[model samples]
Target chain A: MKSIAIIIKKELRRFFTDRRLLISVFMPGIMIYLLYSLIGNFLFSTPQSQEYKIAVQNPSATFQTVLDGYMQSEEVKDTYSLTVIESDGQAEEKKKELENKELDLLVIFSADFDEKLALYMQGVKPEQLPVMQVYYNALEQSSQSIYTIVTTLYDAMESSLANVFEVAGGNVATESDGFAYMLSTILPMLIMVFLFQGSMMMTPESIAGEKERGTFATMLVTPVSRSAIAVGKIIALSLVASLSGLSSFLGVIFSLPKMAGMSMSGLNIAYGFGDYLLLFANIIVLEMLFVALVSVISAYAHSIKEATAYSTVLMIVVMLVGMVSMVGTLPSALWVYFIPVFNAVVVINQIVTFSVSALGVALTIVANLVCVALLVLLLAKMFNNENIIFGK
Target chain B: MEEILRAEHLRKTFKISAKQRKIERTEERCKVAVNDVSFSAYRGEVFGLLGPNGAGKTTTLRILSTLIGADSGDAIVCGCSVRKQPEEVRKHIGFMTSELKLESFFTPSYLFDFFSELHGVPKEKAMQRKQELFRKFGIDRFAEVKVGDLSTGMKQKASLVISIVQDPELIIFDEPTNGLDVLTAKVVTDFLIELKNMGKSIILSTHIFSLAEKICDRIGIIVDGNMIKEDTLAAITEKRSLEEEFFALYAQIKGENL
Candidate 1:
């Protein structure tokens, strides 16, 4: 135990005293915050809408009154400027203008449209109503917006003329609930990725770097057991890597509002102190598992560069597993909680959305501990293997 | 004389990769690094294994130190079998070679204390030993400097001191002065003599005849994974100088005129 503590102290000293290593471990969070903020600003700010041009033939006073009322009420009169023109039988030409982008939309009605509409409003069901032909270029954004608004207004008017019953209180979800749902899908994946990246940054340097520099051989010659060395390294790496993971978690928490174009008010992110403690405990154990697994890979590698290259494959695997949080729902199968990286990602998703179960958390923690113990044993065996340690 | 170490028919072989075969320009798939080699050293004696490069001297030392295992035989160090009880063997021996390196990020003092703790030395005894050894080697002046920032000689001295942190019964050194300046080499040779006078058993490998002659009480000559000669220094040099004797033995093995 004393030997393990000494080794841990030495490793901690190496991590805390080195400026370059410290910067590398903590830089990802700062970068993520700045980049996410920029994206949010760009996405949420409303862009200037272009003025839409519309030409009408055989215009109806009733329809014009409805359009004017809708536009005036919305105070968007500057967005669409309607021009009334008499029927010149130039419908095809006007359509050509719309396709050419010169006119945003075109509206045409039959010559007796007012008479047909007046009969229809008196509860007389006619064989057919006057046809209203609308033309707009779907490729143009302004044209699409105007077409949608005008069609909506016309439909509303038509529905009111034939009203029988009404529907009320359609959607009950608040804006905050919607935002929380959005975050639940993405934040879990981000946290897993950050945790993995943090482990990768330090594990290779501590193990493979020592081998390459010949320092590991020095340690191996000592009377201490190889397992002691492995345990010490895993414990120290867990603490250091957890710091890195926490930095990224804090980054996501503080910057999430801007990224989602919303305020933190009423968001379901408020958890109790016990909940946060559970979250951190999960993080530490998960990091230990990561460190143990990476240590084995690092031990197998001949040098630090090779170790880093091999660890990338693990990174990709973890990323694919993390993306499981973005699915429709977290897996309810009890056996899934026994899987290593996948289980942690699931439990973290559960924690943030306030759906975690004690059984699931317990199973995940136990499974992670079991796997970390196994990997540490494997690492100790590798450390004792002369071929693996010396690359003979 | 009391025996401090023994090797009985030790042998080690390595499988050569295709890439290595290409680089070495050889078709052999396996290389016998050490073959049926045996020797012994006693208490309060400096036993030197002298041989040419690639003659398996370092390989023999490594096997004895428990860094690597022999395929066929065993080495007993301080009454502990290296193959059966490697950790126990390690506790009784101090092994130093160019291959073992100190972490450059740490100061010499930190590493010294760290290694002492690993060897399970008492705290006060370790500190006293550290002070004595550091002052003896002039490492006290730069003990707090990082190993990487120190000069090569200083790094070698620090490694030498840390290797003996436990004050083991047997000390195995592979080429103790392979790359040192003249002054540093003198210091190392003088230190070896001092340790010998203090009744420590030392087993060192070297190709330099003068170094072996200067400090070695008994010397063994190895050639191509084979022990060619093992005798007291006076016996090996009775008819010819150590260099002349070595070349004569080499010529006899190669069947060449010299």
Candidate 2:
């Protein structure tokens, strides 16, 4: 144990002193935050154009008056600035304009507008109704608003018709805020990616790098058991990997508002200082398991290149498992809590979503620790095998 | 003098697959690496295992260092049988190789301290040994610099310092001066002499005969996994230079093969 501590201390000092390692660990945090923020800015910021050009063919004066009244309504003006093109040729020209993405949506009112409006009021499918050909050349928030406005107009035409001139108002319930949705889903996945990336980059460099630099053989000849050296390396790598994991978590937290465009005003991502501490604890365990796995792979390899190749494939497999599990609904099987990398993704997802059960978290920790122990032992065995150690 | 390291009829046969192509089925058989070789190093003697590349010098060193188990062998290091008491053997021996690498991120002081503590040296004693070694090896000047920043010679010195920090009963070095500059090689050769004089049994394996000729009390020349000749340097060089005797042994073995 004392020897292990000495080894760990030496490893930590080496890690801290290495500029390449420092950058490899921390650069992802900075880059991930910057990339997500840029993407979020593009996703949510309102575009400059607000016009919805509609082409109408010959229409009754009353329908034209209603259309003009609907266009002037506060809701329509707030959501879209409507342009009525006069002729079919003009409508075709406007359709081309909309196709070219000059307009958000194009509403064509034909000669059977009133007839189709009646049919739509009678609960006929909107797509089956011959009322208006609504051509939305662009998909945006305003395009959906225009569809809703047209539906309400059809309903009013069959009823008292007075409500057609009145704007529909009142907030509707949303499934969840964009940030909350993203926090529940995307953040967990990003954590998984970041964790894997950290492990893949650091573990081989920790073990095979030491071997390449001649430090590993120096450690092996000491009185320290091969197991102890393996443990010490796993712990050192886990610490560095966990640091990177925590940095990624913090990066997401700090970059959330900028990336999601939704104010974190009332939204708490459950990743506060306390959560950060817990996350660090979780990450330490996860990283140990990851690094142990990597160490075994690296120990089997003779050089850094071979180790890196093996680790890269391992990391990809782990990442893919995490990714597939993230997008798919959580499996209810109790055994899923015992699988190594898969279990980590499930636990992290639960933690991010604030739905983690104590039992599930405990199982994840226990299972991962057991897996890490097995891998560490395997690595020790490999270390003791001269054929593997000397690349025979 | 007590025998600090011994091997009796040691044989290490590696199972190598004879595969002509990647997809072909292959047969496996024992390809001998160390063939029925036996030798002993007594206290205060610098024993030399002289061999060309692939002559099983490393395999012998590794087996003695407890890094691997021989297929059929009994070895003892400082009264500990390597087969049954490897941990004890590890405790009693200090092993170094030019093939082993030093971590570039750590200073020599840190590496020395790490190995000293690892080998169960008390902190105060370890620090004392560290200071003495740093000064003796001229490593104190760069003790604070990251090992990666040091020259190859400095790294080799650091590696040697760490290897010998425990001051074990037996010290094994395989090609210790393989990559050292002339000055550094001289330092290492002189250091091995000093260690031998201090009553530590040493095994120096290298292709360089001149250094071994100067320091080794007894030389074992291995060729093709076999110890072709084992004798005192003076006995082997009787009426001939060390280089002539080395080649004469090689030529005689080759003539037998022909």
lDDT of 1 by residue, B52-136 (tens): 9999998899889888888999988999999999999999989888778899999999999999999999999999999998998
What lDDT score is found at residue B34 in candidate 1? 86
lDDT of 1 at A199: 87
lDDT of each: 0.87, 0.77
Residues A1-392, model 1: lDDT tens digits: 98889989989999999999899888888877788878887888666655778888888888679777876765354456777766566777888888988898898888878888988988787677887888899998788888898899889988887888886776687776666677778877887788888888888999999999989989988998899999999999888898898888787877788888876564445578878888888988988888888899999998889988998998888888888778767776999899888899888888877788999999999999999999999998888887987774
* Superposed model 1: Cα runs more than 4 Å off: A46-167, A174-180, A266-270, B22-28, B177-199
The sequence of per-residue lDDT tens digits that candidate 2 reaches over residues B134-223 is 898789999999888998778777877788888888899989888778987877887787787777788989999788888899899999
| Residue pairs with clashing backbones, model 2 | A213-B101, A213-B102, A214-B101, A214-B102, A215-B101
**Per-residue lDDT for A1-392 in model 2, tens only?**
87678768877887787798799789878987788788878988765635554444554454556656787766544434556677778878877776676666666666766766666657674565455566664355655565666657756664663344656686563423445556656665667767776777777877776666656776777768888888888888888888887777777776777765766563554356755555566677887887788788888777789888988887777767767644778774789888877887777777666667778877888898999888988888888887776654
In order, the interface RMSDs are 0.8, 1.4
Grade the docking of candidate 1: medium
